[model samples]
Target: MNKAQEKPIALSIRNLVKTYGKVAAIDNVSLDIASGEFLSLLGPSGSGKSTILMAIAGFVTPDSGEILLNGQKIDALSPEKRQFGVVFQGYALFPHMSVRGNIAYPLKLRGIKGAELDAQVERTIDLVHLSALADRMPRQLSGGQQQRVALARALVFDPSVVLLDEPLSALDKKLRAELQFELRSLHQRLGTTFVNVTHDQEEAMTMSDRIVILRDGAVQQIGAPDSLYNRPSTRFVADFLGRANFLEGAVSSVNGTELKIDVKGIAVRHAKGKDAAAQGEKTLLALRPERIAVVSPDQAKTSLNRIDGSVQTSAFVGSQYVYVIDTPLGTIESQMPAFEAGPLRQPGAQVAVTWSPEAGVLVKDK
Candidate 1:
């Protein structure tokens, strides 16, 4: 299986460019989606995530470049000839159709009928766990059930690839989370290549095997969720994926693997990463808010990185306490779990803020 996985690419988007009048919706985007893998195109609204997806679906014609599926050029193929299953944002089910009718729509379109259609519809309804509600109308089904119907409709045709466009965006937070897990499980069961588009970072992180982040109609970074979260390639990626503290400063000294930076009247030390500029060059430290801590004076006094700050504001979340510290390096946010050994600092109280050198990630100044 591993050898087969390395044999050939499943889908390749090479320098795909789509322009509408003066605007370039998909600006020279390229990607290689592996067989039986789940990939996500994630970005905020108007970032061209949907445009790239529509291009892949053959709905939008590109100005240049090529789209290859299984090493075959597919840019000229019509949407129907592409043979890719697509689940749109809205359920898009026919209101008059029953759950079984909706699930069997694609199979019907393929000209399958009689016992074959009945068997396929039964199998699909069972696959989506909608056997009990097969007779229910679209208006009678819940949002989650309707979503399952949509998914069943997409998978009923047996397309080798599946495209989902914010399939669970209409659901509540908890329901959406539940459906994300369900979608992952379905993908695992089917072993079909899935390319999903969404702006929800958590959804992208939890559901995708890899995520492609887009900005200004181009791909900014493509990697596993953890890799993208831990080592963001750009400031836009770091800020968009999650909350990060931007510490701007100039490099003061470089000693082997460690480098010292002068930031906001305070000297802060960090590990020298590949993206770090040369000595004396300005850089920005991208530190996760949760990585910083409010240390007591007796907790491991170190000369490397230390700052005295007052708590500008504090909030007690259910599982943790969030604090904003007003220091020389602007306002740095820190999170402390509620079950920790000691009491947390109150608002307007002086506290010692500290983070290890490894916790602070240095990148090119943005």
Candidate 2:
């Protein structure tokens, strides 16, 4: 299998509470991290993600809570006893130490010397593909190479878990993507629990097995990436995970599982997921830009939810052309594939946007 599976849970945090002066950095946070699972804590700045990571690493003591490692309480244990490897944004490599010495630091501290230290260091260096630069110092290596060194050092000690705090934020976009692949590959090969904290949605979605969304120092929602993206529990998650266009409406009626709502002067239909909206309740329909289709008015299908609008602007953004349409429901954004051979609509050109009822995400107005 490509993924690490069938292992037991590795860590559990119950009722974790922490405060800084009058601010609650983390409030009643509880999460279970599975063994060999890659989970990410995603949020905006000050959403308490880094605070949660620090609490897990035992670097920042919480006001109250119990942290359990493999069912044993570890709140009173120090960071060294936790045996969790940590890699931060800056890499934090020892500038005076060579790559081999850097990777061997933790082992050497435990009195592992001679051929054993060499074997361990060489093994980790091979894991990170740094054999060519094993003799280079931190200042002599590039940003990506230094990141690999940090990763190698973290893994060389064979820690029970690894906590990464914006580990790839220092690298450029292309290099970050490359490192993301290497990180995931390492996880699969080693089968170690990895907890990552980041504000970047794409990075979390790309590398994590599950994502926990946080807002204002509390849990907003937690689930698989696609589940959270397609069926967000609230407006914040739908907007933050990706670009979404909101169409406000009041619930007119609910027929069994389907919902009929009134948007502006038009009646729109949407399918409910898990929760149904009450009649007369204000709700917002969150539709993704790429989920919309722009077609000629004559060719619009009857089964699709169709809206006629004038194209306000169209801009080519790499692989897709984003079009802003001025419809009765205010402004809506639609993305069409850039390489597709079709008639390009100009500003002021009349067009129709169509999408299935399944594509409409019904989110509470709050």
Using lDDT, give the best candidate's number: 2
Give the runs in model 2 whose Cα sits over 4 Å from its true position: 1-6, 273-275, 301-303, 341-343
TM-score of 1: 0.94
lDDT of each: 0.87, 0.89
Clashes of each: 0, 0
How does candidate 2 fare on TM-score?
0.95
Worst 10 residues of 1 by lDDT: 1-10
Model 1 Cα shift for residue 225 (angstroms): 0.3
**All candidates: TM-score:** 0.94, 0.95
RMSD of each: 2.2, 2.1
**What is the C-alpha lDDT profile of model 2 across 174-234, one tens digit per residue?**
9989888888888989988899999989999999998999987899998888889988878
Clash list (residue pairs), candidate 1: none
lDDT of 1 by residue, 235-271 (tens): 8888999988898889898887888888877888898
